[model samples]
Every structure is written in C-alpha cells, then in structure tokens.
Target: MSSSLLPFILFALVASISPGPTNLLILAHGAHNGLRASLAPIFAACAAAAAIVWVVGLGLGEVLLRHPLAQQVMSWVGVLWLSRLAWQLFRAAGEPLHATARQRFGVGSAASLQLVNPKVWLMAVAVIGVFATPGLPVWHLALVFLIIALPCMGAWALLGIGSARWLRSPRHLQRFNQLLALLLLVSAWSALLA
Candidate 1:
C-alpha cells in the first residue's frame, strides 16, 4: 500500500460508513428484508456512488460549482425526495408485515437515490478536490471508493440483519421503523437547514 493512498482510503471508509440517507435506507431495508435481499441494493448504491465520483471528477463538479442555483435546486429536490421516503417508512411502521415483497427497496431505486443524494455528490467533489492527484486517473479514485464502500455498507446490512432478530415483534418493529423515519427526516432536512 502506497503511503499516498492511505488518507484517501481513510476518507472513503469514513464517507461510506457514515450514516447518510443511503446507509440509513440500506439498514432499514436489510432489517425489513434479509442479507440476501440487501445485496443488490448494496452493489447498486456502491456502483452509483463510484460513478458519481467519476463523473464529478471528469467535470460535473465544475458545472455544479459554476451554478449555485443548480446546486440549490438539486439540494431542494434531494431533500424533498428523502422526506418522501421518510414518510413512507413512517407509514410502513403502522402497517402489518406482509409476506409479499411487493414494496422492497431494490437495485434501481438504490441507484436512483444516489442521483439525488447530496451526500454522494459532496463526497465526490471532496474526493476529487483533495485526493485526485494530477497524474492519477479519476477512475482510480472511483474504483478505490467502490472497493472501500462495499464492506462498510455491508456492515450496515449486517447490523440490520442482527436487528431483525430483535425486531421480530410488531411493537418492536414499529418503534424501530418510526425511529428510523425520524432520523431520516432530520438527516434529510439538516443540510438545507444548516
């Protein structure tokens, strides 16, 4: 391992492991579904985030920086979308657990969430600005992020799996869902409010 790569690796680990909207949603999904079901979303999310890093490094970050209005619009849209998800999670708290996997959070939704995920874009910008050496390819950083993110996000899924055991009862599950919803609501709104 080159010494130059260590800091970037640390940054990627922290960014991926931290509880953002995506991580929260993944944890919730894993709890609702299982590890097997969580795998697709995990891969999708990691890939999407890596893609964002690559694109942002390539020039999207410059475009976004030049347009404050665009950034504002994106932020508002992302917050609104997150708020909607939070509401849905809150509503699910009251509903009885149906055996049908009708409303499961899948790969497509996970990837789409990355498009609107402010955290992802911000992290991409930071990664480019700070870690992207002049000689290093953007794809190198993207690949590094993807590699570091997998197990970090997977840890969240494992936590969800463990929590699933504790959340067996309806009352417990309801409380857990409600708590996650509240957290998601706060997280979604805090960036704009700050």
Candidate 2:
C-alpha cells in the first residue's frame, strides 16, 4: 500500500467507525432485529457513503458548502428528519418484537438519509479536499471510502447484535429501545444546535 493512502484510509476508518447517526441506527436495529435483518441498513449506509464521496469528488459538495443558504437548508432538513426518526424510536418500545423485521431501517431510507447527513457530506468533502489530488482518481478514492466504511459500520451493528441477547426480556428490550431513542434525540439535537 502507498504511504499516501495510509492517512486517508486511517481517516476514513476513524470517521466512519466513530459513533454517528448511521452507526447508532445500525446498533439500534441490530439490537432489535439481529444480524440478518440489520444488514440492509448497513449496506444502505455504505452505498450512500460511496455516492456522497463520488459527488463530493466531482466538486458539487464544495459548491453546496460554500453557499450558506444551502447549508442552512440541509441542516434544517436533517434536523427535522432526525427528530421524526427519534420520535419513532421512542415509540418503538411499545411495538411487538415480531414487527421488528418489517420495521427495520431499509436500504432506501438509509441511502436517502445521506442526502441530509452532514457528517457524510463533511467526510466526503474533507476526503476530496485532502486526498483527491490530480494523480488519484476520485472513483478510486470513493472505493477506498466504501471499503473502509462498510466494515466499520457493520462492526457497530454486530456489537449491537451481541447485545441483543442481553435484551431478550420484553421489559429489558423496551428499556433498551427507549434508551436508544433518547440517545437518538440527543444526537439529533447535537446535530442541529451544536
């Protein structure tokens, strides 16, 4: 591996693996639905990250970020959408376990979420700015991002899967779900005001 690529790979790993809405969602889903059912959202997030990196490498992300109005609009949209998801999570504790499969965060929604996910945009734009020199192809950089990102995201969900067993009882599961919901809300708020 080229030394030039190491820093970027490390950056991608840390940024993607660190706690974020996507990871939180993955963990939550894994806890509720187990590994098999949690894969969709993980893949969705990976696809979304790839797409975001590609678009940003094309320079569209920088253009969007340069405009304050656009940034504000994106932030608001993300905040509103996240708030809604948080509410749903808060209420999820009341639903039956059998409904988990049907209620899981699917590919479409997870992919769509990237549009409003500031961390994704930031990661893409930062990667493009830092690593997308003339010698490197943007697509390859995107692939690297995906290569590193998918596993990191999956790890979090898998951890949640491990936690699933601990939360088997209805009362325990409900409390776990409610706690995740509260964390989701806090995450949304941090995204908005922080």
Candidate 3:
C-alpha cells in the first residue's frame, strides 16, 4: 500500500470511531433495537458521510469556504434537529425498550443527519484538503472512508447490543436512554460553541 493511504486510513478510523452524535445515536439505537435493526442506520450514516467527502472533493468544499453563512445556517438547523431528537429520546426514557419502535432512528434520518451535521461536513472538507492528492482521487478517499466508517460505527452498535444485556430492567434502560440523550445534546451544541 502507498504510504499516503496509511495516514488517510488512520484518519478515517479515528474520525469514525470517535464518540460523536452519530456514533452515540447508533450505540443508543443498537441498545434499544438490537444489531439486526441497527444495521440499516449504520450503513446509511457511513454512506452519507462518504457522499459528503465525495461532494466536498468535487468542489462543495470551495463553495462552503466561500460562503461562511451557509455553514452557520446548517449548524443552526443541525443543532435544532439534534436537540429535538435528544428531547424525544429523553422523554421516552421511561418507556419500555420495545415501546421505542415509534421513535425509530432509521436510514433516512441517519442520512439526513449526516447532511446537516457540521462536524461531518468539516471532516469531509478536512479529508479532501489533507488527503485528496493528485494520485489519490476524491472518489478513492470517499470509498475508503465508507469502508472504514462502516466497521467503526458498527463497533458502536455492537457496544449497544452488548449493553442490552444489562439494560433488561426498565429503570436501567431509562437511565441509559437519558444519558445518551444528554450526551447527544451536548455533542450537537458543542459544535456551534466550538
């Protein structure tokens, strides 16, 4: 493998594995829904993130750089959406895990979250700027990111699935949900504050 690819792979792994809003949501979802059900959202999020890298490499990064207001707008909208999700998750903490089917965080929502997430965009831009060399095309970076992200995000889901064992009781599940919700809220808002 090329030396450049190693660094990019490492970068992708760190970015995807890090505890961000998406990873946290996946973890919470997996804990609530199980790995079988959480697979769709996990794939959706990885694909969406890859698509962002591809688009940014295709010049969306330049457009975003030229228009700071657009980033601000997206940041506000994303934060609001995340806040809403967090609120819903918190409110549903008292409900049984099976009762959370109504609050499903599905493929579309996962993809949409990536679209609005400033952190995702920023990461895409960074990947393109730092990794997209003359020999390493944008598509290559995106494809690599997609490949790396899947398992990284899946790891979060697996954690959730594993935690499901301990969350058998309603009270334990409630606390878990509330904690995840709080973390999600903080993760979303911290981007703007940063």
Give the CA lDDT, 0 to 100, for residue 137 in model 2. Answer: 76
> Which residue runs of candidate 2 sit more than 4 Å off their true CA positions?
none
TM-score for all models, in order of appearance: 0.95, 0.91, 0.96
The Cα local distance difference test for each model comes to 0.88, 0.81, 0.91
lDDT of 1 by residue, 1-194 (tens): 55558899989999999888889998988887888999999999999999999999999999999998998899889999999999989888855445414678899999999988888888998999988886667899999999999999999988988898888788988998899899888877875665
TM-score pick, better of 2 and 3? 3
How do the residues 51-147 of candidate 3 rate in per-residue lDDT, one tens digit apiece?
9999999999999899999988989999999899899889988888778755777999999999988779879989998999888999999999999
Q: Return the lDDT, model 1, position 79.
A: 90
CA deviation > 4 Å runs, candidate 3: none
Model 3 TM-score on a 0 to 1 scale: 0.96
Arranged by lDDT with the best first, the candidates are: 3, 1, 2
Model 2: colliding residue pairs: none
RMSD (Cα, Å) for all candidates, in order, is: 1.5, 1.8, 1.1
